[model samples]
Target: MKFTFRKYERINKQKEIDAVITGGRKFFENGLLVYILKTDRNYSRIAILVSSKVEKSAVIRNKFKRRIREIFRLNKYKIKTPVDIVVVATQISVRQKYKILEESFLKILNQNGILNL
Candidate 1:
């Protein structure tokens, strides 16, 4: 499959985001705050939130967003159900290496029981 995160696969609508924020199950692991809500769609969608409080530099924030997005983009297909996912990064995440970040993300997926193998 082509490695790409399309606009449709992103949780960009305010209503959708708000629903996840208000009702999704929350998980905190490896400096990442994950919010997930089951959806009726055929596929999952994602959003990455990196607040300025996490880092003062826009460059750093964008970089962190890209890394988190990439991690989700690559592993999203493994999810067994359709879900709206929001990944919020904390300050501790900025200092971690890519591998560690990926591991942490996978751990969260595993913990949620959504990861298929």
Candidate 2:
């Protein structure tokens, strides 16, 4: 089955912030990183952040977002908890392959105890 993260689940509301800030954590790995805040709900959400400082063009930024989303879609099962994940891209990410980026992200999630495997 194909699993997806929708926009409405994103941590945009004040209530979401309170849930995260009171009990959230972060993780980092080569070429990828994540900030995860567990939620009491039963779903996951994602926000892919690519700053213009890394890629000035909107096209490039969107490309980065797409790559991040695709990676998350393929590996969402690794995460066993309901959480909000924010992925912020760096300059090095633009030069890395998708596999490397996905691996790095998974590593971080695993380290943070967010991933079951």
RMSD of each: 1.1, 2.7
The runs of at least 3 residues in candidate 1 whose Cα sits more than 4 Å from the true structure, single-residue gaps closed, are none
Any residue pairs clashing in model 1, and if so which? none
Write one digit per residue (lDDT tens) for candidate 1, span 36-106: 99899999899988888889999888888888889988998899988889888899987677888889888
Q: Which 10-residue window of candidate 2 scores lowest in summed lDDT?
A: 14-23
Model 2 misplaced regions, further than 4 Å: 5-23
TM-score of each model, paired residue for residue? 0.93, 0.79
lDDT of 1: 0.87
lDDT of 2 by residue, 32-54 (tens): 65678877778777776677888
User: Which one is best on TM-score?
Assistant: 1
Deviation (Å) of 98 in candidate 1: 1.2
Give the Cα error of residue 32 in candidate 2, in Å. Answer: 2.3
